[model samples]
Target chain A: MANNLNTRKAKQKTLTVLKFVFLFIYLVVVMFPFLWMLTTSFKPSSEINGPVDYIPNNPTMENYINMLVKGNFGKYMLNSLISSTFAAAVATFCGILAGYVISRFNFRMKTPVYLLFMITQMIPSFIMLAPLYQMLSKAGMTNSLGTLAILYANMTIPFSVVTMSGFYAGVSNSIEEAAWIDGCGYVRALFSVIVPLLLPGIAATAIFAFMNSWNELFMAVMFVDMDKFKTITVGLNSLILKYNIKWGEMAAGTVLALVPTMFLFGFAQKYMIEGLTAGSVKG
Target chain B: MKSNKRLGQRRNIFIFCMLLPAILLPLIFTYYPLIKGGVMAFQNYTLMDIKNVSWCGFDNFANILSNEAGVDFGQIAKNTVIWVVVSLALQFTLGFALSLMLKKKFKGAGLYQGLIFFPYAVSGFLIGIMWRWMFNGSNGVINDLLMNLGLIETNVGWLAQKETALLSCMIANVWYGIPFFTIMITAALRGVAPELYEAADMDGASKIQQFFNVTVPSIKSVLLMTVLMRVIWIFNFPDLIYSMTSGGPANSSQIITSYMMTLVYSMDYGKASAVGLMVIAFLAIFTLVYMGATKYTSED
Candidate 1:
């Protein structure tokens, strides 16, 4: 019995040690690229191509300063902010109302409407991209950020609605029914009861919609040529495109562009995971 | 009955009022452009001739098929297939392993998840640019490492070589996509009930057996859905590849989306539109077939 107990304890210790070792390797593989990008961003441009030394002997802010001075980094940052915020706000508002209607009322197209929204999301985003450019040009709004916001809103609303529907589904209808019995209308009950409950979903959808618009490089690169109108993703992409090869400055720009997105994700990660798992796990 | 019908009609109108923005947005943006774009596939249109276009019914398709449009689309189609199947299969496998390993009661799981999902937030174009920096022929981290490790005697041009350009591009894609599948399947794995595992454990099933018999069956729905969606996504665009290689090394990595962009390069939207239509049609047929098969089999 003593031998058996000793062997069991030894096996348990071995398993624990094995698990820790594998976890360390997993962490290294996952974090290496991002941390490399961070380290490379700080290193002097001269040392960028040197030996396999991960750390720079001398670091400088020359690349960041050069990028800011030589390029439209500030302007593009503002452009992305304006475009992404506008898209997120409008899309979330539309999604809230539509979700409320879906959750509250029964209509002929209730099931079909939900399915349609899902299908719209499933279709290749680029399938209509080329034609949309022409359509935008026809409307004489290809270069306008206002028009970009409208397009982004359309692209994100289906996702927003699907997510909002889930949020509403989770929040019981009993409270809203109580509101209705208390002489409230559909819109009133939604505003007073359901809206507060769906805050996390709205927050998640808003962050995602913002990310979608902010990170939209293809359309911006294709459509908007005017420097003043272009967003950050397009601007950085064009910087790389027009100039074939510049490692340090491009890395600097990419790093700068990625900062805000990481901050937003850091804030809304819990909600985003909940939204993702709850929505797609059933599929 | 008429009064009740009128009241019901009023509620229906109210619901429609709420749904107007949802309906109108996709109609104008998605449906209208889809039709307009379909028409472009039939016309000889250019960015310059948007206002003044001439119809060229099936010419683009026929010309592409016959190799008359200077596209040699047969080659692009082949490259596209090679790219989609290889990278997608690898991504699936990597994603599966990551999900399974992470699904087990391991420490640092949250940190692993956060790090993995970080890549997905970076724009596709920026991802290409990031990889380009890593694959820089003269001064890349990868080359430096390989040399230091004595794996290579000299610097090897990664993106410039035809043999490795597609694979290099695939490396970037796999890195970007691994997170999406991991997060999705990890969540799916969590939904697997403990009782099934307990039952398997009681039967003296090994850990590996429990995985195959319990875990796989539990997440099959998520697996199938993600596979379809990921294929649809990866198959459609060459934007990421374009940002990386631009179908370089004598068009060795040319896919349909990259081919489309090349048309824009040559100012030949007429042909690009046809390829675009083919892509959409292919997806449409796939959806129909998959849904048909599901309905037929599920009756059992």
Candidate 2:
């Protein structure tokens, strides 16, 4: 018995060590690109095309300055921010309303409406691109940030609804009922009581919507042609298409564009997991 | 009794009002465009000559399928299959393994989880650009590292060649996608009961056996759903391919969706819409079959 236990312990130790080694390697593979991007962003134009240097010897902010001033990245960043914020706000609000109704109320059209939203999740935005472009161009709405925001909101609505509904499902209705007994109206009770409780879930859903809008390249590239209207994705993409690719400035712009999403990810990671798993596994 | 009836009617009105924006958005944005695109698919609706637009009666579809279009439809179909299958299989397998390892709590697990899941937040286009530079023929980190490791003596033009362009994009797709499965499977794994594992252990089952029996069955629904969702998303995803290769080097990297994108760029709305319809048809069929298979298996 003693010998068996000793061998088992040794085996467990080896397994633990092996697991760590595997995880470490995976981590390196996953993070190496970001690290490389980071290092490359700080390097001067000369060092970027010169011998492969893992780290920048003279880490300068010249690339960032050039990208901001010359590349119109600042304008692109602003456009991205305005559009994504509007998209997130619209999506989250509509999601909250739709999610609440679906979760709390069962009207005659309940199942059909739910299925409609679910089916939309399967439809790729690419399919709608041609017609949407035509419609926007005909209406002279192409190259407009407001138009872009609306499109982004529309794109995010289905997933946002599903996610918010998952969250609403998790919250018991008893609390809302109790608030109602205390003379809180439905809208007021939702705003004051349930909304507070679902704040994290709402944050997660909004962050997701924001990230989707921010990252969208296809629509931004297609619907908007003007330099002033371009998003960060379009700007960075155009930089690559130039005859002489500016690797340093391209890397800097990418790093800069990643900041908001990365910052949001740090805060909303737990909520996002809950929201996504709840949306998928439960639904 | 009359007042109560009135109250119920009022509540119904409120509900309807709450759902109006949700209903209107999808109707206008999704269904209307879908219908319009469907019509445009059969018409000679190229943006270059909208005044001459007329119904072409499947001409666009025929041209594409018959290789009359500039792109090779057959090669594109094959590329799409390889891209989806290889990327999906590797991502699923590796992601599942990573999730299993991360299941048990250990020192610095949170930090490790954060680092691994970081890619999920990054944009697909940005990932493509990052990988594009990394796979650059000259002065790329990949070539540099490979040479240092003595794996290859000279630099290889990954994106410049038709053979390797799609493969390189697939590599990026795999890397970008693994985190999604990890995030999802890890969440599902947490919901599995420890008692089931204990029972399997008591039965003298090996770890692998226990995993197959207890863990698999418990998380099967989540697994099935995640895979289905991922499949749809991957089918839709052309951003990476677009930014990485732009479906270039003789259109070797072009998937069906990205092909549609190129058509849109050329202002060939008719052909683009036709290709878009093909994507929808493919996805619809795939989803139906997937659902049927999963349902049949679950029933069994």
Candidate 3:
């Protein structure tokens, strides 16, 4: 009996070692690319060509300079920043107010409208891809960054509503009823009572909108033209196509594209989990 | 009292009017695009040269189906299936396991959750580029690391080679997708009643046994919904394909979206829209199946 217990303890210890080993390896697997991208961003031109040579004997910042200075990184970043941020802000504003109405209203067609908004999220983005490109192009809205913002806002509002509606459901109706009885109108109650309660939900919805627009490549790739209008995804993609084998510059540009979301995610780390999980698990 | 009721009715109408913008946007932007695509599929159009238009009917699709017409779209369709299924299986399996790990309280659990979900926030295009760099043939990190470790005798050109290309794409895709399941499943796990586990424990059931009997059933609703949504997403999105390989190594990994993009860019509008139509058809069928299954399962 003593021997069996001792052996079991030893086995458990071995399991701990194996479990940690697995985790460590998985971390390496995930983080390896990020590390490599960083390394590749500084590699000299000669060493950038091969399969097994991401590192350079003589590292340089020349590639980074070339990418930003020559490749319009500032313009691209600014374009993405302006368009995506605009989209997020506009979507959040309308989405929250509308989500509140849908949640609290006893109007006709409420369920259908909500269902329509829900289904919008599930439609293959590709089905809309060509047509949106066509229609927007015809409208002459494709060229402007504002057009991109509108497109982004349109894509994100469904998701924003679905998640935000769920959140408003959680934000007790009694509070709003109290405000209603105090001679506050529905709009005033929504603005003063319900809106404040939905701060966390709005934050999550904003993040989702921002992330969608930031990561958006299809719209960016299809519509935008000229150097000044290229968002980061399209810009980096075009950079790679035009300058194949320019490893450092490509890496630098890609990393630059990654920064905003990385910053946002880091700041609001807690809500990313709750916001994504809530609607996701529920739906 | 009569005036108050009238006021209430008026308020409801006003509330709905406020929802008009949200409603109108999707109607125009979302559904209109789909309707446009439905029509556009029938016309030979390159907006760049819209003057030289012709009606192709279903000729684009027919050519692909007949194969003698030499479009080779059958290959693209086959690749789309492979991309979706392979990704779905891997993400579900790994995500399930990761969620299982997170079910237990641990030191730095928050940090672990944060790290795991970080990939989901990383842009798909960047994931494509990051993987492309890692899979770089001669001087890439994967080869370098493997060579240094003395694990492999030769450098493997992961994304560049036909055989390895789709699998390499899957590696990055799986990374991006796993976090989604983990987040959803973990949330489900939180909602799972501890009473079920307690009862199972009283029966002297093993931990693994309790997991299967209690945990699985409890999270089944969440599992069903998340899986449905995920299946739809992976089937539709070919973004990784666009960025990673661009349907390269002889179009071996050309999912439908990438194929459609190539055709459209080259002004084969009739064929591209036909391909786009095929994707919509698939999605429509898939959504029907998903909703049917959800309704069916939930009923029982």
Candidate 4:
């Protein structure tokens, strides 16, 4: 009996060690590209070629300065920020209403409304590209950041609605009922009572929507033709197209583009994970 | 009592008003374009000559299907299949393995999870550029590493050659996809009941057997759904391919979606719309069949 127990302990220890080893290797594999990009971004143009060093020997901010000044990456960054923020904010606003109704109310058209929202999540955004471009061009809205924001909001709304509804479903209605009994209107109760409770959910939905718009490439590329109006992704593509081989500048630009999402992810990792899982798991 | 009933009706109207933008925006932006795309597929539409846009029944589809435009629709379809299947298979396997590893909590797990999941938030376009630079034949990090390790004497033109361009793009895609699988499978694993594992252990089931019986069955629905969703996403994902190769090296790396992008770029709206419609129809059919199969199996 003692021998068996000893063997079991030994086996458990081995398994634990194996797990750590596996995790370490996984971390290296996952982080290598980002680390390489960081190092390469700092390297001077001359040192970017030939044998690569894991660490930059003479790191300089020239690449970054060039990207901001000559490459006009600052303008692209501003464009992305405006579009993503606007889209995420508007989508979340619409999502809160739709999600609340779906979760808290039952109406004659509830089933169809719910199904419509769900079906929207399944369709690819690319299918809407050609026609959306056509429609926006007809309205003379093409090549504008406002049009991109509207399209992005449309892309993000379905997922945000689903996520917000999931979060709302978890909150009990007793608080809202009490608010109502105390003479608060539904809107008042929602803002003063339910909104506070759903802050984390709201954050999650907004982050998801923001990330969607920020990272989206296809729609931005299709809609925006002018360099001044281009978002980060499209602007980067233009840079690559114009300059055949500028690795340092490209790396710097890529790293700059990643900063906002990375910071957002770092701060709100829990909410983002919760939101993503909630969205997918419920489906 | 009558006033209360009227107030209730007012509240319903208020709720409907609140929901108006949610419903109408999708109808206008999403469904409208979809319908327009369908209509445009049957017409000889060109952005350059919008005044001459007229009905051209089945011609656009035939043009692609018959390889009339030199786009080689048949090869593109084959490449699309290969791209989706290979990427999905590798991603799902790697993701599942990573999830299983991450199932049990350990030191620094949070940090590791953050790093792993970070790639998912990065734009596919940026990822393509990063990988393209790394795969450059003359002065790429990959070649430097390989040469230093004495693996190959010469630098490989990963994205320059027809034989390796698609594979090179697939590697970047796989890297980008790993996190998705890990995030999803890990979440699903968390939902698995602990009691099932204990019960399996008590029944003298081995670790492998317990995993197959308890873990797989519990996360089956999530696994199926994520896989199906990924398949559709991958089919429609053109950013990485567009940025990396632009379906170049003689269009060997071009998948159907990127081909559609190329068509759009060349102002062939008719062909682009037709391709878009075909992709939508294929996804609809695929989703139906996949969901039906899963439902049938679950019943068993």
Candidate 5:
């Protein structure tokens, strides 16, 4: 009996050590790219092509300065900010209304409408690529930031609606009903009673929508031709196409582009997880 | 009774008004483009000759299938299949393992979760560029590390080589995809009741047996749906390939969607539309089969 207990303890220790080893390896894998990018961004152009060093021997801010001053990265950042914000705002606004109605009301054709929204989530955005471009071009709306915002909002709305509805489904209807009995209309109750409760969900959906627009490359590259109106992703692609491989500047640009989403993700990590898992868990 | 009826009608109108933007935006942007794309697939359309476009009736599809005009559609289709399948397998396995590891509570677990999930927030295009630099032939971190460890004697041109180009892109894609599975599976795993595992333990089941019998069955639907969604998304994804290799090294890494993008770039709208339609059709069929298989199995 003592022998068996000793063997069990030994086996448990081995498993624990194995788990740590695996976790350490995963940590390395997840972190290596970002660490490399961070290091490369600070390296001088001369040292960039030299033997790869984990840490830059002589770090410099020249790349960031050059990107800001001469590369028009600032303008691109502004464009990205404008479009992403607009898209997220509009998508979330529309999502809240649609989500509320779907979750609260029992109407005819509700199942069909909900299914349509779900189906939209499955359809690849590429299928819409050619015709969307053609339609926008025909209307002479291509290359405009406002049009890009609308397009991004369209791409983000389905998921936003689904997420918003899931959040709404979580909140009990009793409070809203009480507000209704107290002589508040539906819109007033939504704003006064329910909207505050849904703040975290709204923030999560907004961050997701913003990230979608900010990270979008295919449509941005395809639709926008003008340099001034290009988003960060498009600008980075153009930089690659135009320049002879400038690794330092490119790395710096990538780091800068990653800032907003990373910052948002850091603060809203819980909400982001909740939002992304809503479909899988609740469905 | 008349007043109540009037109020019901007004409420319905209010609901409709509230949903106007959500309903109308998709109709104008999504369904409209989808229908137009189907129509454009059969028409001879070009951005340059839009005014004089006419019906072509499957010629574009025929041309692509036949490998006319040096497009090598067959090769592209094969590459796409390999890309999606290989990347999906790796990402799913790694992600599942990570999720399992993370399911156990430990010190700094939240920090690790944040770090692991950070990559999903990064743009695929930026990830492509970062990986492209890392895989550079002469002075890349990957080569530097490999050489230091004496694993490789020479710096291999990972992205530049024809054989390794697609694989390199897949590596980047897998990196980007891992967090998605990790986030999803972790969430699903968290939802699994601990009572199930305790019940299995009382039955003298080992950890492996419990995982297969209890954990797997519980997360089966989430796993199936996530995998299906990923397969379709990865199949349609062209951003990483486009940004990293641009379908280069003699189009060895070229996938169908990237080929479609090239067609679009060259202003061959009809061909692009045809390719788009083919992608939609393939995904539609695949989704149907997948849903059917899952439904059939769940009935057991």
Candidate 6:
């Protein structure tokens, strides 16, 4: 009996070690491309097409300098920042109001309204590409960053409403009811008491909206034709479309483009994960 | 009672005001365009001749379907099927495996999870750019790595060759998508009760047996929902393909959505709209059929 127990324990230890090894390998696979991009971004133009160096022989900041200066990437970043921020704000505000109504009110159109949002979320954004292009162009709204921001807000609203509705459902109605007893109107209670309580949830939803707008390539590529109004994705994509692709500058541009979303993920990873998994886990 | 009635009227107004923007934006942006696109699908809506826009019913659809417009819709349909099925299979299997390993806490598991899940935050376009370079015909990391590993003696033109182009994109997609499943399934796995495993153990069930009988059954709903959401998402995603290949080398890597993108790029709005309508219709039908099938199965 003692011998058998020892063998089983040894087998368990081996299995555990194997699992760790497997996990470690996957982690490397997951990270290798990003690491490669980083290292490539640091390498000089000459070293890029040469033997692949896991670590650059002599890392330099020239790529970054070139991307920011010669590549017009700063303009792209600014456009992205302004548009995404606007999109996030508008989306969050509308999402909160709609979510609050859906969660709290006993309206006649509640289910239908909620279903409208849900079904729209399932519909692909590209399906509207042609008509939107026509409408915006007819209105002379193409190439306008502000217009792009509004379109993005429209793009993210369905998701924002759905997610915010989930968050609102989690908060108790009693807090608002108490406020109502204190003579607070529904809107007043929502903005004052409930909004403060759901700040983290609001942040999560806004971050998601911001990232969606920031990362949107199709709309930006279609709508924004002018160089000055281009977002980061469009900027990077144009570089790829150019003949004789510049590897170093492209890598640098990609790295610069990723900073905001990656930083947001690091800062608010918890809320983002919670925002994503909360709905499916419960439902 | 009169005061209460007045208050109720005020509350209803407030609610309507609150919901107006959310409802109105979609109505203006999504619904209006949906209707316009539906109309444009049957019209000669080319950007080249916007003034001559007149109804041309079924011509765009017929041309695309019968290979009249050089689109090879049959190949595109096949490519889309291959793309969705292959990418979904690999992403789900690999992601599920990683989640299973990461579900139970181990030393440094959190950091590993964070690092592995980092790609989920990276945009699809960026992932495409990274992979496009990595899979470059010459001077690519994939080629270098393969040579080093003794897997291939010569460099392969991953994105240039018709055979490997779609496959290369699929690899990048798999890489980008694995993190989503990991994040989702890990959460679902954690929600599974420990007592179920214990009961299975007491019944002398093997580890694999317990996994299949207990853990899988416990997370079945989450799994189904996640898979459904992912299928729609993957089908909608054309960003990576557009960035990486642009359906290049005689349209070898062209899926239905990417082909629509090419039409959009060429300013063939009528054809693009037709394809868009087709996509929406297909997805609607697919969603209904999938939900029906899953609901039927689950009833047992």
- Give Cα-based local distance difference scores for all models: 0.79, 0.89, 0.79, 0.86, 0.88, 0.88
Candidate 4 positional error at A2, Å: 3.2
* lDDT tens digits, residue span A1-283, model 2: 9999999999999999998888889889999999899999999988988889998999999999999998889999999999999999999999999899888998999988988887787776666888888788889999899999999998899888888989999999999999999998889989999999999899999999999899888888888999999999889878978878889998999999898889998888888878987866654
Runs off by more than 4 Å, candidate 5: B1-7, B296-300
- Residue-level lDDT of model 5, residues A1-283, one tens digit each, is 9999999999999988999899899889888988899999999988998888889999999999988889999999999999999999999999999989998898897888887776676666766778888789989999899999998898889888888888898899999999999999989999999999989989989998999889988888889999999989987888777648899999999998988989998988888888888756767
CA error at residue A55 for candidate 2, angstroms: 1.2
Docking class of 2: medium
> Cα RMSD (Å) per model?
2.7, 1.8, 2.6, 2.3, 2.0, 2.0
Candidate 2 per-residue lDDT over residues B59-159, each given as its tens digit? 99999999998778999999999988899999999999988988887888877787789899888889998998899898799999999999999999999
* TM of each candidate vs. truth: 0.92, 0.97, 0.93, 0.95, 0.96, 0.96
Put down candidate 6 lDDT per residue, B1-300, tens digits, no spaces.
999999889878988999999999889988999888889889988889988999988999999999999878999999899889999999999999988888889877766776788888878888999999999888899999999999999989999999989999999999999999999999999998889888998999999999899988888888888788888888878879988998877888888888888888888988988898888889889888988988823222
Error of 6 at A99 (Å): 1.6
Output the lDDT of residue A251, model 2. Answer: 92
DockQ of every model listed?
Answer: 0.52, 0.66, 0.58, 0.60, 0.65, 0.66
Tens-place lDDT per residue, model 5, B111-132, is 8898889988877788888888
Off by over 4 Å in 2: B1-4, B296-300
Model 3: how far is A281 from its true place, Å?
A: 3.8
Q: What's model 1's TM-score?
A: 0.92
lDDT of 1 by residue, A202-265 (tens): 8998998898888887677767889999888887776776745566777788888889999988
The ten-residue window of minimal lDDT in model 1 chain A covers: A118-127
lDDT of 1 by residue, B244-299 (tens): 88888788778877877777556566776787788878878987787676542211
Question: Judged by DockQ cut-offs, is candidate 3 incorrect, acceptable, medium or high?
Answer: medium
Best by lDDT: 2
Ten residues in sequence with the least summed lDDT for candidate 5 chain B: B291-300
Task: Give the runs in model 3 whose Cα sits over 4 Å from its true position.
Answer: A1-18, A50-57, A280-283, B52-54, B149-151, B294-300
Q: Rank the candidates by lDDT, best first.
A: 2, 5, 6, 4, 1, 3
Answer with 1 or 5, whichever has the higher TM-score: 5
